[model samples]
Target: MNDDRRVYGTDRGEDPRPQPGRVYAELVGGPLDGQLLDVTGWTPDAILDGAALITEAGAYGPGGRALYDPFPGDPSRWSWSGDTP
Candidate 1:
Protein backbone atom coordinates (compact mmCIF):
# COMPACT_ATOMS: atom_id res chain seq x y z
CA MET A 1 0.00 0.00 0.00
CA ASN A 2 1.47 3.31 -1.05
CA ASP A 3 0.26 6.83 -0.32
CA ASP A 4 1.21 7.72 -3.84
CA ARG A 5 -2.37 8.15 -5.03
CA ARG A 6 -2.96 11.22 -7.17
CA VAL A 7 -5.62 13.82 -6.51
CA TYR A 8 -7.64 15.04 -9.47
CA GLY A 9 -9.78 18.14 -9.30
CA THR A 10 -11.17 21.17 -11.14
CA ASP A 11 -7.88 22.99 -10.70
CA ARG A 12 -7.32 22.70 -14.41
CA GLY A 13 -10.65 24.52 -14.90
CA GLU A 14 -12.24 21.51 -16.55
CA ASP A 15 -15.64 20.12 -15.70
CA PRO A 16 -15.53 18.12 -12.50
CA ARG A 17 -18.04 15.47 -13.47
CA PRO A 18 -16.61 12.11 -14.33
CA GLN A 19 -17.78 10.72 -17.64
CA PRO A 20 -19.96 7.65 -17.16
CA GLY A 21 -18.47 4.35 -18.27
CA ARG A 22 -15.00 5.85 -18.07
CA VAL A 23 -12.32 6.71 -15.56
CA TYR A 24 -9.65 9.42 -15.91
CA ALA A 25 -5.98 8.48 -16.08
CA GLU A 26 -3.18 11.02 -16.11
CA LEU A 27 -0.89 10.56 -19.05
CA VAL A 28 2.81 11.04 -18.67
CA GLY A 29 5.29 12.25 -21.25
CA GLY A 30 4.91 10.50 -24.64
CA PRO A 31 2.46 10.28 -27.50
CA LEU A 32 -0.99 11.24 -26.29
CA ASP A 33 1.27 12.76 -23.72
CA GLY A 34 0.10 14.87 -20.77
CA GLN A 35 -3.48 13.86 -21.45
CA LEU A 36 -5.97 12.04 -19.28
CA LEU A 37 -7.37 8.80 -20.56
CA ASP A 38 -11.00 7.99 -19.98
CA VAL A 39 -10.40 4.33 -19.39
CA THR A 40 -13.57 2.84 -20.74
CA GLY A 41 -15.04 0.37 -18.23
CA TRP A 42 -11.60 -0.93 -17.41
CA THR A 43 -10.97 -2.04 -13.84
CA PRO A 44 -7.79 -1.40 -11.90
CA ASP A 45 -6.30 -4.74 -12.88
CA ALA A 46 -7.39 -4.35 -16.47
CA ILE A 47 -5.85 -0.87 -16.67
CA LEU A 48 -2.53 -2.23 -15.46
CA ASP A 49 -2.48 -4.85 -18.19
CA GLY A 50 -3.87 -2.61 -20.91
CA ALA A 51 -1.58 0.26 -20.04
CA ALA A 52 1.21 -1.41 -21.89
CA LEU A 53 -0.86 -1.29 -25.07
CA ILE A 54 -2.96 1.78 -24.46
CA THR A 55 -1.01 5.00 -24.63
CA GLU A 56 -3.99 6.75 -23.09
CA ALA A 57 -3.61 4.76 -19.89
CA GLY A 58 -0.94 6.40 -17.74
CA ALA A 59 0.21 7.74 -14.36
CA TYR A 60 2.25 10.60 -12.91
CA GLY A 61 5.40 8.99 -11.56
CA PRO A 62 7.89 6.51 -12.94
CA GLY A 63 5.85 3.31 -12.50
CA GLY A 64 2.91 4.44 -14.66
CA ARG A 65 0.50 2.88 -12.15
CA ALA A 66 -2.46 3.91 -10.03
CA LEU A 67 -5.92 2.91 -8.76
CA TYR A 68 -9.27 4.63 -8.51
CA ASP A 69 -10.47 5.84 -5.17
CA PRO A 70 -13.56 4.08 -3.90
CA PHE A 71 -14.80 7.15 -2.04
CA PRO A 72 -16.36 9.61 -4.43
CA GLY A 73 -16.24 13.35 -3.80
CA ASP A 74 -17.38 16.60 -5.31
CA PRO A 75 -14.90 18.50 -7.54
CA SER A 76 -12.17 16.14 -6.51
CA ARG A 77 -11.01 12.52 -6.77
CA TRP A 78 -8.36 10.23 -5.31
CA SER A 79 -6.71 6.98 -6.26
CA TRP A 80 -6.73 3.79 -4.19
CA SER A 81 -4.34 4.43 -1.34
CA GLY A 82 -3.16 0.92 -0.42
CA ASP A 83 -2.55 -0.68 -3.81
CA THR A 84 1.00 0.60 -4.27
CA PRO A 85 2.49 -2.36 -2.43
Candidate 2:
Protein backbone atom coordinates (compact mmCIF):
# COMPACT_ATOMS: atom_id res chain seq x y z
CA MET A 1 0.00 0.00 0.00
CA ASN A 2 1.05 3.59 -0.56
CA ASP A 3 1.92 4.87 2.90
CA ASP A 4 3.14 8.25 1.78
CA ARG A 5 1.35 11.23 3.27
CA ARG A 6 -0.94 13.35 1.08
CA VAL A 7 -1.14 17.14 1.24
CA TYR A 8 -4.18 19.16 0.16
CA GLY A 9 -3.72 22.29 -1.96
CA THR A 10 -3.53 23.39 -5.57
CA ASP A 11 -2.39 20.91 -8.19
CA ARG A 12 -0.41 23.62 -9.88
CA GLY A 13 2.76 25.05 -8.31
CA GLU A 14 1.35 28.53 -7.91
CA ASP A 15 0.77 29.77 -4.38
CA PRO A 16 -2.74 29.05 -3.09
CA ARG A 17 -5.32 31.75 -2.73
CA PRO A 18 -8.96 31.42 -1.81
CA GLN A 19 -11.34 33.26 -4.12
CA PRO A 20 -14.70 32.83 -5.77
CA GLY A 21 -14.72 30.01 -8.36
CA ARG A 22 -11.27 28.87 -7.20
CA VAL A 23 -10.65 25.14 -6.73
CA TYR A 24 -8.92 23.26 -3.90
CA ALA A 25 -7.81 19.64 -3.53
CA GLU A 26 -7.38 16.60 -1.32
CA LEU A 27 -6.28 13.01 -2.01
CA VAL A 28 -8.67 10.59 -3.65
CA GLY A 29 -8.52 6.89 -4.61
CA GLY A 30 -5.90 4.41 -3.36
CA PRO A 31 -5.26 3.77 0.33
CA LEU A 32 -5.66 7.38 1.52
CA ASP A 33 -9.15 7.78 0.12
CA GLY A 34 -11.69 9.34 2.50
CA GLN A 35 -9.00 10.09 5.08
CA LEU A 36 -8.12 13.64 6.12
CA LEU A 37 -4.51 14.50 5.28
CA ASP A 38 -2.52 16.73 7.63
CA VAL A 39 -0.20 18.96 5.66
CA THR A 40 0.80 21.50 8.29
CA GLY A 41 4.40 20.35 8.26
CA TRP A 42 4.92 21.59 4.72
CA THR A 43 2.03 23.93 4.27
CA PRO A 44 1.12 25.86 7.40
CA ASP A 45 -2.33 26.54 6.00
CA ALA A 46 -2.43 23.18 4.20
CA ILE A 47 -5.41 23.18 1.81
CA LEU A 48 -5.46 26.96 1.90
CA ASP A 49 -1.99 27.04 0.37
CA GLY A 50 -3.21 25.98 -3.08
CA ALA A 51 0.13 24.56 -4.19
CA ALA A 52 0.95 20.95 -4.91
CA LEU A 53 3.09 19.23 -2.30
CA ILE A 54 4.82 17.25 -4.97
CA THR A 55 5.32 19.57 -7.89
CA GLU A 56 6.51 16.86 -10.28
CA ALA A 57 3.14 15.05 -10.09
CA GLY A 58 3.06 11.34 -9.25
CA ALA A 59 6.65 11.72 -8.12
CA TYR A 60 6.08 9.99 -4.84
CA GLY A 61 3.22 7.50 -4.78
CA PRO A 62 0.38 6.03 -6.84
CA GLY A 63 -1.46 9.33 -7.20
CA GLY A 64 -0.67 12.21 -9.47
CA ARG A 65 -2.93 14.75 -11.15
CA ALA A 66 -5.46 12.01 -11.77
CA LEU A 67 -5.69 11.27 -8.07
CA TYR A 68 -6.49 14.87 -7.14
CA ASP A 69 -10.15 15.20 -6.28
CA PRO A 70 -12.32 18.16 -5.35
CA PHE A 71 -12.51 18.54 -1.61
CA PRO A 72 -15.78 17.41 -0.17
CA GLY A 73 -17.47 19.74 2.28
CA ASP A 74 -15.79 19.76 5.68
CA PRO A 75 -16.69 16.78 7.87
CA SER A 76 -16.27 18.65 11.16
CA ARG A 77 -19.79 19.86 10.70
CA TRP A 78 -21.19 16.41 9.88
CA SER A 79 -22.18 15.57 13.43
CA TRP A 80 -23.12 19.15 14.24
CA SER A 81 -26.82 19.86 14.36
CA GLY A 82 -28.92 22.37 16.27
CA ASP A 83 -27.88 20.69 19.49
CA THR A 84 -24.41 20.89 21.18
CA PRO A 85 -21.97 23.64 20.41
Candidate 3:
Protein backbone atom coordinates (compact mmCIF):
# COMPACT_ATOMS: atom_id res chain seq x y z
CA MET A 1 0.00 0.00 0.00
CA ASN A 2 1.05 3.51 -0.64
CA ASP A 3 2.14 5.36 2.48
CA ASP A 4 2.05 8.78 0.90
CA ARG A 5 -0.27 10.91 2.95
CA ARG A 6 -0.24 14.05 0.92
CA VAL A 7 -3.58 15.78 0.49
CA TYR A 8 -3.92 19.19 -1.01
CA GLY A 9 -1.13 21.15 0.67
CA THR A 10 -0.95 18.96 3.71
CA ASP A 11 1.27 16.02 4.34
CA ARG A 12 0.89 13.39 7.03
CA GLY A 13 4.55 13.26 7.76
CA GLU A 14 6.53 14.70 10.65
CA ASP A 15 6.27 18.03 8.89
CA PRO A 16 2.66 18.19 7.88
CA ARG A 17 2.72 21.38 5.94
CA PRO A 18 3.25 22.74 2.48
CA GLN A 19 6.70 21.92 1.25
CA PRO A 20 9.11 24.21 -0.47
CA GLY A 21 8.82 24.92 -4.23
CA ARG A 22 5.14 23.93 -4.31
CA VAL A 23 2.74 26.69 -5.26
CA TYR A 24 -0.63 26.72 -3.54
CA ALA A 25 -3.81 28.73 -3.88
CA GLU A 26 -6.01 29.39 -0.90
CA LEU A 27 -9.68 28.47 -1.21
CA VAL A 28 -11.93 31.04 0.36
CA GLY A 29 -15.50 30.29 1.49
CA GLY A 30 -17.67 27.45 0.19
CA PRO A 31 -17.28 23.91 1.46
CA LEU A 32 -13.57 23.93 0.84
CA ASP A 33 -12.87 27.09 2.70
CA GLY A 34 -9.30 27.42 3.90
CA GLN A 35 -8.19 24.52 1.79
CA LEU A 36 -5.20 24.78 -0.48
CA LEU A 37 -4.97 23.97 -4.14
CA ASP A 38 -1.65 22.96 -5.62
CA VAL A 39 -1.12 25.25 -8.56
CA THR A 40 2.48 24.31 -9.19
CA GLY A 41 3.43 24.47 -12.85
CA TRP A 42 0.00 25.86 -13.83
CA THR A 43 -0.07 28.57 -16.44
CA PRO A 44 -1.38 32.07 -15.77
CA ASP A 45 -4.33 31.49 -18.08
CA ALA A 46 -5.26 28.29 -16.30
CA ILE A 47 -5.18 30.07 -12.99
CA LEU A 48 -7.42 32.83 -14.30
CA ASP A 49 -9.93 30.31 -15.63
CA GLY A 50 -10.26 28.92 -12.13
CA ALA A 51 -11.74 25.54 -11.28
CA ALA A 52 -14.96 23.73 -10.38
CA LEU A 53 -13.88 21.97 -7.25
CA ILE A 54 -15.73 18.83 -6.27
CA THR A 55 -17.22 18.78 -2.81
CA GLU A 56 -19.49 16.53 -0.81
CA ALA A 57 -20.64 19.47 1.30
CA GLY A 58 -22.15 21.29 -1.64
CA ALA A 59 -25.49 23.12 -1.64
CA TYR A 60 -27.30 20.05 -2.93
CA GLY A 61 -25.03 17.77 -0.88
CA PRO A 62 -23.00 14.87 -2.27
CA GLY A 63 -21.72 14.65 -5.82
CA GLY A 64 -22.09 18.38 -6.32
CA ARG A 65 -19.43 20.81 -7.44
CA ALA A 66 -18.27 24.07 -5.95
CA LEU A 67 -17.38 26.85 -8.32
CA TYR A 68 -14.41 29.01 -7.44
CA ASP A 69 -12.86 31.88 -9.28
CA PRO A 70 -9.53 33.55 -8.91
CA PHE A 71 -9.76 36.50 -6.61
CA PRO A 72 -9.11 39.53 -8.75
CA GLY A 73 -5.75 41.17 -8.09
CA ASP A 74 -4.75 38.19 -5.97
CA PRO A 75 -3.47 35.23 -7.89
CA SER A 76 -2.83 33.26 -4.72
CA ARG A 77 -6.45 33.11 -3.65
CA TRP A 78 -9.66 31.65 -5.04
CA SER A 79 -13.01 32.99 -3.95
CA TRP A 80 -16.19 30.98 -3.82
CA SER A 81 -18.54 31.80 -6.70
CA GLY A 82 -21.42 29.31 -6.32
CA ASP A 83 -22.47 25.68 -6.31
CA THR A 84 -23.42 23.43 -9.20
CA PRO A 85 -25.30 20.19 -9.62
Candidate 4:
Protein backbone atom coordinates (compact mmCIF):
# COMPACT_ATOMS: atom_id res chain seq x y z
CA MET A 1 0.00 0.00 0.00
CA ASN A 2 1.22 3.49 -0.81
CA ASP A 3 0.88 5.79 2.20
CA ASP A 4 1.72 8.74 -0.01
CA ARG A 5 -1.58 8.35 -1.84
CA ARG A 6 -4.03 11.11 -0.93
CA VAL A 7 -7.57 11.94 -1.96
CA TYR A 8 -7.67 15.38 -3.51
CA GLY A 9 -11.25 15.04 -4.69
CA THR A 10 -14.06 12.52 -4.62
CA ASP A 11 -17.25 11.83 -6.49
CA ARG A 12 -19.08 12.64 -3.26
CA GLY A 13 -18.25 16.32 -3.63
CA GLU A 14 -15.46 16.60 -1.10
CA ASP A 15 -13.03 19.49 -1.21
CA PRO A 16 -10.60 19.15 -4.13
CA ARG A 17 -7.74 20.75 -2.26
CA PRO A 18 -5.18 18.46 -0.68
CA GLN A 19 -5.51 18.11 3.09
CA PRO A 20 -2.38 18.07 5.19
CA GLY A 21 -1.78 15.24 7.72
CA ARG A 22 -4.48 13.12 6.15
CA VAL A 23 -3.79 9.41 6.25
CA TYR A 24 -5.34 7.20 3.60
CA ALA A 25 -6.17 3.56 3.16
CA GLU A 26 -6.69 1.73 -0.10
CA LEU A 27 -10.24 0.41 -0.42
CA VAL A 28 -10.39 -2.86 -2.35
CA GLY A 29 -13.54 -4.46 -3.83
CA GLY A 30 -17.22 -3.47 -3.40
CA PRO A 31 -18.62 -0.25 -4.84
CA LEU A 32 -15.72 1.75 -3.44
CA ASP A 33 -13.16 -0.42 -5.11
CA GLY A 34 -9.86 1.32 -5.82
CA GLN A 35 -10.91 4.32 -3.76
CA LEU A 36 -8.92 5.93 -0.96
CA LEU A 37 -10.33 6.32 2.55
CA ASP A 38 -9.18 9.03 4.91
CA VAL A 39 -8.24 7.12 8.05
CA THR A 40 -6.25 9.71 9.87
CA GLY A 41 -6.43 9.47 13.69
CA TRP A 42 -8.19 6.11 13.53
CA THR A 43 -7.23 3.97 16.48
CA PRO A 44 -6.22 0.33 16.21
CA ASP A 45 -9.43 -0.65 17.97
CA ALA A 46 -11.48 1.31 15.48
CA ILE A 47 -9.64 -0.29 12.59
CA LEU A 48 -10.26 -3.73 14.05
CA ASP A 49 -13.95 -2.94 14.41
CA GLY A 50 -13.97 -2.07 10.69
CA ALA A 51 -15.97 0.63 8.95
CA ALA A 52 -19.23 1.06 7.08
CA LEU A 53 -18.31 3.46 4.33
CA ILE A 54 -21.06 5.42 2.67
CA THR A 55 -21.24 5.12 -1.10
CA GLU A 56 -23.88 6.04 -3.66
CA ALA A 57 -22.74 3.07 -5.74
CA GLY A 58 -23.64 0.48 -3.12
CA ALA A 59 -26.16 -2.31 -3.66
CA TYR A 60 -28.89 -0.24 -2.07
CA GLY A 61 -27.83 2.76 -4.11
CA PRO A 62 -27.64 6.20 -2.52
CA GLY A 63 -27.46 6.31 1.30
CA GLY A 64 -26.20 2.74 1.35
CA ARG A 65 -22.96 1.72 2.98
CA ALA A 66 -20.11 -0.58 2.02
CA LEU A 67 -18.43 -2.47 4.81
CA TYR A 68 -14.66 -2.67 4.94
CA ASP A 69 -12.20 -4.39 7.20
CA PRO A 70 -8.56 -3.70 7.68
CA PHE A 71 -6.17 -6.16 6.07
CA PRO A 72 -4.52 -8.21 8.82
CA GLY A 73 -1.07 -7.79 7.32
CA ASP A 74 -1.55 -4.20 6.19
CA PRO A 75 -3.10 -1.41 8.19
CA SER A 76 -3.05 0.90 5.18
CA ARG A 77 -5.41 -1.35 3.20
CA TRP A 78 -9.09 -2.06 3.70
CA SER A 79 -10.81 -5.00 2.01
CA TRP A 80 -14.52 -4.99 1.22
CA SER A 81 -16.65 -7.36 3.25
CA GLY A 82 -20.22 -6.56 2.13
CA ASP A 83 -22.88 -3.88 1.78
CA THR A 84 -25.45 -2.48 4.14
CA PRO A 85 -28.80 -0.80 3.76
Query: Going through the candidates in order, what is the number of backbone clashes in each?
Result: 0, 3, 0, 0
Sorted on TM-score, highest at the top, how do the candidates line up? 3, 4, 1, 2
* Prediction 2 TM-score vs. true: 0.22
lDDT-superior candidate, 2 or 4:
4
TM agreement with the true structure for every prediction = 0.33, 0.22, 0.78, 0.77
Ranking by lDDT: 3, 4, 1, 2
The TM-score, computed over Cα atoms with residue i paired to residue i, of candidate 3 is 0.78
Q: Which pairs of residues clash in candidate 3, taking residues 3 or more apart in a chain or in different chains?
A: none
**Cα RMSD to native, each candidate?**
11.4, 14.4, 5.8, 3.7
The Cα RMSD in angstroms, rounded to one decimal, for candidate 3 relative to the true structure is 5.8
Please name the candidate that would achieve the greatest lDDT relative to the true structure: 3
lDDT of 1 by residue, 1-85 (tens): 2223332333466654454455566543443333455565666655554344222234444444444432233212223432221
Best by TM-score: 3
Tens digit of per-residue lDDT, candidate 4, span 1-85: 3333335235576663336677777888898787678778989898788899787798989898999999998978899999999
Writing each residue's lDDT as its tens digit, candidate 3 over 1-85 gives: 2223233435356454555777778888998887778889999999999998777798978878898889999989899999998
Which 10 residues in a row give candidate 2 its minimum summed lDDT? Answer: 76-85
Worst 10 residues of 3 by lDDT: 1-10
Better of 1 and 2 by lDDT: 1
- Local distance difference test scores for all models: 0.41, 0.33, 0.79, 0.77
lDDT of 3 at 33: 88
